[model samples]
Target: MRFFCIALAAASCAFADGVGIAFPQENALLPAVKRTYVIGAIPAADATQPLTIAGVTNDVYKTGAFIAMVPVEGGTNTITLTWGTNTLDRTFRVAFPSPPKPAATNTPPRDVRKDLGIPPDEEVSDARPKGKRIEDLTVMIDPGHGGQDTGALMPHGAGEKTVNLLQAQAIEAEFAKYGIKTVMTRTTDDEFPALYARPRRAYAEKVDAFISVHHNSTAADRDPREVRHTAAYASTPNGLALAKAIQQYVGPQVTGVKNAGAQMRSYAVCRNPAVASCLLEIDFINLPEGEDAALNDADRRSRIAHAVLIGFLDWLFAPDDGT
Candidate 1:
C-alpha cells in the first residue's frame, strides 16, 4: 500500500538498522476509544533492547515485532517509539463520536440542513468520486456564530453571522469539488451551538482539520472601517501550516484584503491539541469595503474559498520531518 511504502521510506532515513513501522502505519487515524495499540518491528539482533512507547515500556515483544498499548486522548495524540539510541514518533487523531445531548422539553434536536436550504437527502452523496489527496480526510467547518449571536455587525446592520455562514458554505462546496467530506457545526442562521461545543464537535468527528470562519471586528468605540486585514490563528505547528497556507494562498485573492498573517491564539475552535485546526478572519466586516467584498460579493467569496482549498492542498503535500 502507499501508506506502508511511504512509512518504510521514512523509517529508512532515520535508521539504517532495519527498524520499521509495520502496523498502525504512519499518520494513522484511530478511533477515539479508551486504549489502542501500536505495532512495529526492529532488527531481530536488536530485539532484546528495551522499547518504550508513549512512556509505557511493558508488553513490548522481543520477537522483532513490537506492540504496545497506550491510553487514548480526545483530539490528537502523539505516539513516540524509542529503543536503544533511536526513536520514532507518529502523530494521529482519536475522535470519539459526540454523545447525544438530552433534548430540551423532549423536543428533538433541530435539523439545520433543511433550514440551510440543503436537501437532507443530499447530505451524503458518493456520486462524486473521492480525490486521492483528500480521500478519507474530513474537515469540520464551524461558522463562527449564529442565532442570537450576531457576532460583529456592520454599520448597515449586516450581520457577521450571515457572512460567516455564506463563506463557510462556499468553502465547503469548493472542498466538495475535490471529493473531500466536510461537517458543519451550524448549517443555518437559526442554529447555534455553544461556544465550547464547536471544537468539541470537530473532535467527536475525528476530523483531519478544523476551520472556523469569522469576520474580524474592532472595538465599537473605534471606527470599524479602519480595520482591513485578514488574519488566521492556530495553536499547533501543523495548525500553523494550515493558517499560513490560507494567508499565502487566499489573502491576495481578495481586494483590499491585507495579509495580517497567521498567528498563534487560544481560540476555542483551534485550541484542541489533537486536531490540526485554523480560524480564519477573511476580512474585517466592519470596514465598509471589507463588508462589501466579504459579505456581498459572491465572486469574492468563491475566490477566497478556492484559495483556502489550495492552501490545504499545499499543507497535505508538504514534506514531513524533512522526509
Candidate 2:
C-alpha cells in the first residue's frame, strides 16, 4: 500500500510523550488519517509468518502484511491482533474528534481537519458492500444537555455541552480527512434533545456506531451516584470490546482520565444491536477545574480527541499485545 508516510523524523519534535502512544507532529497516520495507514516493517528474519492481527475481527491479518487503520469515526475500542511471534505487540490508538452535541453546529465552523494537516480528498467507494454498510457506519455524536439542560457546568465557566460539541467537531474534522460519513445529533445552541430522543436518532440514522458525549456533573441535585472516572457503557459483545478499548487507550493518554470500564446499561440508545453504542462520561463537569479545561485550551482538547481516535483504531485494528 502507498501510505502517505508521515516521515517520523520530519514532524516538529513535539512535547514530552505524556499522552498515549506519542508521535512527532508528522506521523504518517495522523496526517493521512482518513485513509488506511500501512505501518509495517519487513518481517524480521525471526518474525513469524502468515502473521495475523486479530483484535478487531477476532480473526487474523494475512501473512507478510502491514497494519491498516481507518480513523473516520471517533470512539474507543479494544481488540486483540497478533502477527506471529514477531508481532505488533502493543495497543494503538487513533485520535478522532468527539461526538457532536445539539449546540455545536453553531459554534463557529472551524476547519480542524485543515489545522491538523490531515490527508486531502481522493474519493473512493467504501469497501463495504451495500447493506452491510449498515455496519458501514455513520457517527451520531450526542453531546448530552443543551440550552436548558446544563450537562455539567465546568469550573472555568465552560458548559459540558460546549465541550461536547467542540470535541465532536474536532472528531468530524478527522473523519472528513478520511472521507467518512457522519451526522451530528444537533448543530444549534438553542434546544435540549428529549432525554429519549437523543438515542433515537442513532436508530433513525442507521448509524453503525453511536456515541453520546457528555461530561458528568457533581451537581448536588444531579444523581449522586454519577461521580466516577472516565466511564463508558455499551450494548453488545462487540460494544463491550469497544468500551474496553476506549478505557484502556484513554487512561494512558489523558492525565486525569479514570477508568470506569464498561457495563451494559438500560439506556434506550445502547440496546439496539444494529449499531454499536457507547456513552463516555468524561470527568466531573461540576468540578470547577474540569469545566474550564474541557474548553479554553486546544492542545488538551486535541489529546482527548486523539485518545478517542486511537482507542477506536486500536479496537478496529487491534494490535496483539502478547499477554
Candidate 3:
C-alpha cells in the first residue's frame, strides 16, 4: 500500500503542467473591459528554465510559463490549458466582481482666487469686459453627445457620447482638487446646448478656457481596419498650444491609441470673446477592436481623463516646460 501511494503521488506531480489567465484581469473589475486574454503555461519547462508570471501588472514574466488567474471584470471566463505533446487540456472558472468606482472629492471649503490678486468673476463679469487675470485660471468643460444622440455606437453598443460625459465628469473632479475655478456646460443627462450656445455660456461666465469633449468617427470604407487615434481641434489659433500639450500627454497614456496631432478647426468658441478654446475628439468611434470598451473602462479611461485635465493645468502653470 505504501509503494502504491508513492507511485500515485509521482503521477500527479508529472501531470501538473499549466494554467490560464485573462487581462485587466485579476482582481477588482469595472463595467468596461479592454481585452480578453489567455495564458497557456506558467513556470514552463522545455529544454528547460523555470516559469514566470506575465500580465499587465505582474512583475514576473516568462516566455512559456503561466499559472493561476484572477478575474478583474466581466463575467466568469474559462481558460483552457493544453499540456505538452499529448495535447491534454485543463479548464478553470473564476468570478469577476465589479470594482467600486472612485469616490468624488468634495469641494474645497474656500476659493483660491482670494490669494491670486484678481477679483472673482462671480456671475456677472459683464461689467469688466476685459476679464480678470488671476494667478490661477477658470475653465469650462463641455461634454459633446448627450440625450437622444448616441453619437457613435459600437457593436456592443458602447456610445461615444456616454464616454464623453463620463470623461468630462472625471476631469472636473480632478480640477476641483487643485482649486481651479470651473464651469460646466451641463451636468446631467439633459440635451446638450446647441453648438453655438455652448461657447456663448462660457464667454458670458468669463471663462478663461473652454474645452469641448467629443469623439470622432471615421467611415468604414476608408478605415476598414478600424483605426484608433487621438486628436485635438482648437478654435483659437493660440489654443493650438493647449491642443499640442493635451495630445502629447493624453495620447501615450492610452497606449496603442494613435495621435492625430493638434489640428486647426474653425469652431464656434475660437472667435468668441477672445477666450482660448479647444475641442478634443478623443478617438475614432465604434471601432471594432473594442476601442469604445477600452475608453469606457474606469480604471484605464479615468487615467486618460485625468491626463487631459493635468495637461491643461500644466499648460496654464508651466507653459515654460519647453514642449
Which RMSD values do the candidates have, in order?
Answer: 23.0, 22.2, 15.9
- Candidate 2: stretches off by over 4 Å: 1-136, 156-158, 219-228, 318-323
- In the range 127-186, model 1's lDDT, one tens digit per residue, is 111243567888888899999998876533546899999999999999999998999999
Q: Record all residue pairs in model 3 with backbone atoms less than 3 Å apart, i.e. clashing.
A: 25-72, 26-71, 41-65, 41-66, 42-65, 42-66, 43-51, 53-60
Q: Worst ten-residue run, lDDT, model 2?
A: 16-25
Alpha-carbon local distance difference test for all models: 0.68, 0.50, 0.54
Question: In angstroms, what RMSD does candidate 2 have relative to the true structure?
Answer: 22.2
| Candidate 2, residue 11: lDDT | 32
- Candidate 2: residue 120 lDDT (0-100): 42
Worst 10 residues of 3 by lDDT: 1-10
Reference-based TM-score of each model: 0.57, 0.52, 0.55
Q: Lowest-scoring 10 consecutive residues by lDDT in candidate 1?
A: 123-132
The order by descending lDDT is: 1, 3, 2
How displaced is residue 289 in candidate 1, in Å?
Answer: 1.6
Compared with the true structure, model 2 gives a TM-score of: 0.52
Q: Put down candidate 3 lDDT per residue, 135-176, tens digits, no spaces.
A: 357788888867777675543344567778877887788777
User: Per-residue lDDT for 1-323 in model 2, tens only?
Assistant: 11122224433122112211111112222321332222232223313444343334221112121333423323332222343322233333345644555664567743322332323462311111223332355666777667877565442333577888876777666665655567877776556777656655555555656667767654222322244467778756666666667666556357365666667665554554445667777665443334445665667666766677676655656544210
CA shift of 226, model 2, Å: 13
* Model 3 local distance difference test score: 0.54
